[model samples]
Structure formats: structure tokens, C-alpha cells
Target chain A: MNKLDNQVIIDRLQAVLGDKVHVLGEPHGLLAIQTESAYILELLAFVKNDELLRLNYLTDITAVHYPLQEKQYAVVYHLHNLFQNIRVRVKVFIGGEQPTIPSATSVWQGANWMERETYDFFGIHFEGHPDLRRILNMDDLDVFPMRKEYPLEDPNRIDKKDFYFGR
Target chain B: MSNRITKITPNNPVFYDNDPQDELITLNLGPTHPATHGVFQNVLQIDGERIVSGVSTIGYIHRAFEKIAEHRPFYQITPLTDRLNYCSSPINNMGWHMTVEKLLDIEIPKRVQYMRVIVMELARIADHIICNGILGVDTGAFSGFLYVMQEREFIYEIFEEICGARLTTNIGRIGGFERDFNAIAFDKIREFLKRYPPVLSEFEELFVRNRIFIERTSGVAAVTPEQALDYSWSGPILRATGVDYDVRVTAPYCSYEEFEFDVPVGTNGDVYDRFMVRNEEMRQSMRIIQQALEKIEKEPKGVFHADVPEFYLPPKEQVYNNMEALIYHFKIVMGEWETPKSEVYHAVEGANGELGFYLIHDGGRTPYRLHFRRPSFINYQMFAPMSRGMLISDAIINMSSLNVIAGELDA
Candidate 1:
């Protein structure tokens, strides 16, 4: 009935999440909150089931590979409450040789393909993903092509040298 | 046994049904089947034509657009978006442009916004025509597909006149259109506007009341509003489930709020309702286009793009003559322009659904990361789950009605 402003939503989130969800400040007006990988599910569950702002729709689940950061991976979730017309972005930073985070498939069934696509591209494993394999690449793809190390152009191509193009 | 497809596998090495009397037959619908519109393989476990389960294998045509976008500059990414939902690429192009514009905080002219609305609504109509017509083809009705496809040519001609290409039309630039609508383009649009209605109504007449069509589609693959929401379904599919959530009305980008049109919804959430909802939305799209044409005439003419010289490519003649224009052109082409560190997610009510671009620009010439929340990719997840109890024919028609464009699906 009342419009759920960012303050009310953030207040509720802070109450339950405490310091886990650090307010990353509104980057482009969407409430982007950062949390550790351990608390992502708790943070996601609270916002989704909260009585006033039931952000029930899982818009998209994607991961960003940040090779330079202390945490090398950031798994992002965009959740929307269609009834209230509000959205909150939940991001969890995880890093290791095998970066894994608790899957959101428990919260949203639609997260299955999204998480699979994320894993396929970023190689960030979802701890409990029902089907965790490549969705958009060959089954035998050895490397995640989206990672920073993987160059777009073929390194072996002699014709594509920057010197040849007069750059 | 080692290669058992408990998860979706590319090839079937072995499949065994323990009970011989009621043994399930494994049927691969396609990585290349006519029923599966775009390239996708659905391995359906069926028993006497009743589907037990289906595992869909996508990614045959995955060009890795997201990977490609990360390496390219903002201006060059339009062609990649053009390929996403090639059926209505102008929307994808505009949506990508709008995302970049949001990052740069560029304000477009009211005239440009109205022009965009016309092109976008036209795309919506073209897309719905292809989809609903294909649904007819999927059903036994062959004549309706032929009749409706004729109208698509006029729309394609309108696009060709505007942007010199059709299908994968990179129709607009950042800030606004590359060029103002020429006289012939407007005339062709006017001609299309006048000609399309009767054909659309006739197409509907053949399918809407046909006892066979109704009986076939009415109760097939029905989903409730709650179920649809759970699957994050958007566009006509979710609308057919009786949810009035449309990104155009809800978020109102590109001055969409200024337009007067209704978001048509359906209650059944079945194959028939999805079909009817798209048909009604096409009518609404026509309404929006008519209003846009009237509204664009009232604005000051010839302002095709926004006034941001920093990003907007200047005319070739100016680049040759002027110093500022030449420097700016060089900076743009070389991807040397400055960008602030920020992340933005912008969604346009694409023909398929809420096609969103999640862009993360970390003070780089190119986006640090860009993720396309493609509607087909998200909505297609529900197909396998929904097809479990239905007959194989119903599953094929259900996939058709959902309008899963593989370009977007495996993007």
C-alpha cells in the first residue's frame, strides 16, 4: 500500500543482516549492497520474504570475474518485487582457486539456468546447483572464456599483429 | 553407464528403460528439428507419446556476445545487441544504447524519444507477427503463416529504408538514430500502418475461432500467475498468466510514459492465451505507433540524435572540416574516451520480454563486464519443467507459443 523507499528497505536489511550487507551506495540509483559469500543466502532470503517488500522475482543471477581484486569473483543477483515495483541487487564476493557460493536455487527455481550460465562463463561454482555444468559452451571447454586471462583474438594468429595494422 | 545423461549431455551414449512393457522412448527434438524454431536440443523421455521428462541442450550457436562485448568499446557493441533478438534487433540496439547513455548521463531530445518509441513499437509488431504466425504454422494452419508473413516484408522495407538493413538491423546509435527518417521511410511507414490491420484481423479470424485451434491450445501448458512469477517469466508469456507487469509501463524509459496504450493481459496462461495476448499487444503496438506519429509531428524537427559530442559520432563532412569533431571522432573510434566507475541495469520491454543489460564500467573505455538478462534465456528454463506431463505435440506447440529465439537463449 505504501511505497517502499530505499531507506525502509535498507533499514530492514540492516536489521537482520547487520554489517554483512555493506551499503555500497546507490550506483546508478539501484540499491547495490555487498556481502560476504557466507551471508548471501540469508540476505537474499530476508529481502525476498520480507512482508512489505516481497522481492519475489529473481530477475537475473550472474557472476563477474575480477582477477585483480582480493576477492576474484563477484556473484550478483538482481531481485525484483513486481508488486511494489522495487529492486535490490545482492552481490557476494568470493575468491579462491575454486570460488564457490551458496546457490540461490533454494530461493528461486529460475536461478538454475542463470547459475549454470554464470558457472559456464565465470567458473564460479554454485555449491548446491542441481545441474552445474556448461550451458552455453562446449561440454569439454577447459577454460572459462570470460575470465581476464582469456583473450578474445587468437594469440597464435600472425596476421592480426598490431604492428601489421599500423597501430 | 559412465556417460549417463543424469544432467543434460550433448550426445546420448546409452539409455535404458527397466520395464520393457512401458519402456520410455528417448526422442531428441532438436539441435536441428523444424519444431524447435531456433537451434536447441530437447531430449524428451516419452512413454507412449506422453513426455516423462525433457532435458534441453542449448548453445549450438552461442557466439559468446558477453565475452565479445567485454573486449569491444561501447559504440561497437550495437552490432552484438543486434544479433541478440534478431527478430526485433532495433529494440536490442536501442536498449544497449540507452544503457550506455545512462552510464554517460546523456539526455536525448523529446523528438528522438518519440521516434524511438515508433521504431520500438513497430519492432514489437513485427516480432509478434512472426511469433503468432509461427504458432499458426506449428499448429496445422499453413495459410495463416503465409498471409501474415507478407505484412512482415512491408515492415522490413520500412526498416531497410531507415537503416539500410533488415533482420540484424543496427538501427540506432547511442544518443539517437544515425540519421533522421527520410521522406520515403515515413511514407512506407504510413503505407504499412494503413495496410496491416485487415491482414492481422484476418490472421486472427482463421485461428481464434477455429474449433481445432481453440481445442488444441486452450487448456494446454497452463501456468498460474504465481507459477509464472516463480519462473521469472516476462512479456506475453507472464502476461498470459494474468500478471500486468510490463517494463514499458512500470519503469517507463525512452518517454514511454507519455504514450497512451493499455498493457493487454490474459487469464488462462495457456498456449491460446499467450497467442491472444500477443495478438492484442500487436493492436496496442499499432495504437502506440499511431500516437507516436501524431506526437512526433508536434516536436521541433531534424534533431535526430542527442547533443553529446563526446560520444555521438559527428558527420563525416564535419570530421574532415572541424578540429573538435575530428578529435572527438578519433577518441570514439579508438575507444579512448573516459568513463566513470559505476554499474547500471537497464531493461527495455523487448519483443520477447524484459531484455536487460547489466553493465559494469570501471572507469574504462570498455565495460568491465556486461551481462544480458535475455528474456528467452530466462523464460526457456520453464519449458522442460512444464512439458513433463503433456503429450509431445503439446510440448512442441508450447515451445512455439513461448517464442524461444535461440540467439537470445544461448547469447
Candidate 2:
């Protein structure tokens, strides 16, 4: 799009989202929208498949963990509107206690696996997922390996003598 | 839940008393599959040749890179990004350094920009060649694989001349390249430019007209442009679906705007289209390399780094001569460099697709969070849908055409 057209879209989005729309860094055409999980599904529905927004593509779904932040986890979705030729980032801040957000599978068919990956990595469940099982990790593995609080395997966790002598 | 799962599997009963119950056949398609570039396994539940359901089993090669970054300095992580997508390591190397430079808000010199472009484009070509070549081999045309490897070896030879290592080319330092291309390397690249077109033509000759290859790939794993974009597929894969969006052109990282090249798009979004798109892309990449070389020639050789001496180690002469430089050198080597307290997502056009590194620095030596946007992992997620109704043989071709390098997939 031309420079003026780009500005108009940005202006409209800014007015719509207000303080929730925090532009990061140099803003090389990435619009990040931070909102609550309650508004996630509605917001996603509005952005995706809408004639104006048309972010019909769900590029990726991942979660970011910030141990020090008050909202401990963030579920990030990268969406691209093929018709509009624009990309937007939808972020939902989830607190530490049983973080969950609505799945975008209804909006974009590709969100199925991306949501599963987010669930696998950060333990943030999609509220209405079809089959929310742990992917990319073994079934019995308890902890979310990508979580900030998940303790890394200690180099000394395996004891050779204990294995051989049956200690 | 167990009953629901059981119901999902088919079952039939008539007058027959002892008929076998239909069940999901679980097959692990390798942490070590020939088609999978590295150690990556996908647990697939199959009904006959069709995949009923599939889940990716990653972390076969998790080296704890983020944790390792916490202990090491910013510069040390360059080598690690190299390992993430070994085929296109320089792009990662340059991308990480650019992120650090952005965090520091430093301006790189014009010549350094040219050098970065050269190295990054070379890596992109190498990655595409292997990816497209392997796609051919997986489809039973082995000649393309050989031709592409020979060319990749030539690319590696140039890389070796520039840096010590070929694949894990830790060639560039923070802000710019580790060293300028020596005369020998320059000559070798020029020779490659001359020799590469014929090799590409020969490789194309083997598969472009072959009826078997065409029949196998032309319509298999067909994804709509909307579907591809929604799934976040980029680079050759995205372009193959007719969307001409390229990170290099749209985002213009590492001075990509200055280079004159075309983003080739395909009409049909299928395995054949993806293959054709990548093939044409390699030619574009060569054009980029040639342009970079011309720019490098016109520009005078000087410092290939930002003036940030603290993050970048001091010159060896200064380290040997001055106490301050010696102390700084030790600190840099020991990874005692202080990182800025900021979050930066630096992305570049990797061979497969958009390779992004989301880094959160805590104003310490270590990063608070490190996430790699692995294109292969995201790209592989589309496999089950793409392979569901296709034959097992076509599924193999689709997997190869997707070019999901397991190193990047599992990491």
C-alpha cells in the first residue's frame, strides 16, 4: 500500500484499540494488540475473515513467558490478511493461575497445531480446542519444558553408580 | 475421552462374530527418517495410507540454547544460531547480530551492510539448493540431488575460504562480518557465479520435463494462498502459493532494498509449484550475490564491525599492547558483556521461510527469553492436512517439497 493508505489503516487501528495498541521498536509494519483473554475470541473474530481486516491467515500461535511480569504468560498469534496485504499480532495476557484463551481454529483452520504448540510449550490451554493434548513432547512428561519456572535437567541428575548398583 | 477416541476409529459388525476392530495405526516417521533433514519424528496415526492424525515429536536435539545464552555472552550465541538452521546459518548469524545492534541502536557502515548481504544471500542459496535437491531425490529423481550438492559444495568452498567452517559458519561478528572476503574467496565466488547457471540448468533438465516427477508433484499437497498465509508459511513456500511477500523486500533487513532482485511467484500452490518457485529463487539469489560483490568491490575495505568495542572484542593488536584492551578482551571472551534491557524481534528471509529470533534481554549478560521462529516447525504442521487424502508416496514427496529441516524443526 502507499504511505498514506498505510497511515490510514494504522490510525483506524490505533483509534479502535487505544492504549492497548502499544507499538514496539521501529514499527516496521507490525501492529501488536494487547488485550485480555475475555476479549480474545471476539477480537480475533473481528480481525480475521472480516472484509476490512481479513487476517485470514494464522501464521503462528506461540506463548511468551515472563516470570517477573504480573501477567505471567502471553499467548501471541501472528496473523496476515491476504487481501489487505497486512500483518497483525494479537496478544492475550494470561495470569499464572491456569492460563487459558479461546482457540482460533474456528477463525483459521491452521491455528490447530500452532495452538497445540503453545499449549505444549507454555501450558496455556485453548478453552475450546477439539483435542488439547501435549504435542512435541512425550505424553507422561509433566512439566512444560519451555516455561520459565520449569527447572532444567540438572547435569548431575543422572548418577552412574545408582543405575549400576541399584541404589 | 477413551470411548470418544475409540468411536473415532471405524468398526463394523454383522452376522460375523469375530471380526477385527478398526484401530488407529501409530507410526513414528523418524527422529531419523531419510526425508527428515535431521533428527525429527512425527507420530502419525494412519488408516491405510492416509494419515488420520499426526503430532510432531520435537526436542530430539534441544541443546538448551536459551539457557546456554543465559550463561554465555551475546557474541557466543552467534555460533548457536548457526546450529539452529545449519543450512542457512549466516542468516541467523547476521540476524542475531542485527538484533543486538538494534538493541544497542548502532548504525552499521555501508560496506558492512554489503558484506552482510553477500554472506546472507549465499547462505540462502545454499539452503534452497539442498532443500529443492532433496525434494527431487525424495521423489525418486536422484540426479537433481547430486547436481544441487555439487553446487552446495561450491558454495561451501567459498564459505570455507571466508571463514574456517563451512556449514556452521560463525563467519560474522556482532554488527558485521568476522572478516572481509579475502582475494581468493572473491575469485572463487566469481568462478561460482560463472559455473552455477549451467549446473542449475542441468538440475532443472532432470526434473522439469520428467513426466513421472510432474505427475507425482504437480497437484499434490496443494494449498491455497489463503491457507498458506494463515499457516504462516513464508519464503519459497509462501511465494510458491502466489503471494509475492518476501521479508527481504517488505521488511528490507540488512539493506536488502538496495539490491535489485525479483520475488518469483507461482500460479499453482502445489509441490511442483514450490519446487519451481525455489528453482527460480536460486537464480534470483545468484543475482543478489553478484550485485553484492560489485558493491563490495566499489567500496573500500575497512572495519567490518560496529564501533561497539565492548560487545565486539578489541582488535588483537590492542589486546596485546594495552592493559585496558586486554581486560576488555578477557571480559568479551568470558561473555561478561552487559546486554541491554529491551525486547527485539529480528527477522530475515531464511532459505525455507521467515526465520525470526525473538530475544528479551534483562540488562544482564544473559537473555531473559529466547525464542526462535522455526519455519520448518511451523511448515511441518501443515503436513497432516496436506497428506490426509494423498497416497503414502505422494506424502513423501510433499514432506520433501516442504523442506522441513529437523534441526530447525526440533530445536
Candidate 2 lDDT over A105-156, as tens digits, reads 8776667777887787789989889878876676787888788777665556
Please give, as one word, the docking class of candidate 1. medium
Candidate 1 residue spans exceeding 4 A from truth: A158-167, B1-19
Question: Judged by TM-score, which candidate is best?
Answer: 1
Backbone clash count, each prediction separately: 0, 4
Worst 10 residues of 1 chain B by lDDT: B12-21
Residue range with the least summed lDDT across 10 consecutive positions in model 2 chain B = B1-10
lDDT of 1 by residue, A1-167 (tens): 88887888888887877888788778777988899988888877887888877998999999898888999989999989888778788888899999999998888888899999999988999999989999989999899998989999887989977899899
How well is each residue in B33-52 modelled by candidate 2, as lDDT tens digits? Answer: 77666776778878878777
Measured with C-alpha atoms, the lDDT of residue B257 in candidate 2 is 86
State TM-scores per candidate. Answer: 0.95, 0.87
Q: Any runs in candidate 2 off by more than 4 Å, and if so which?
A: A1-11, A14-31, A50-59, A79-89, A153-167, B1-28, B35-37, B42-56, B334-339
Q: For model 2, which pairs clash?
A: A57-B230, A58-B230, A59-B232, B30-B41
> Candidate 1 vs. truth: CA RMSD?
5.5
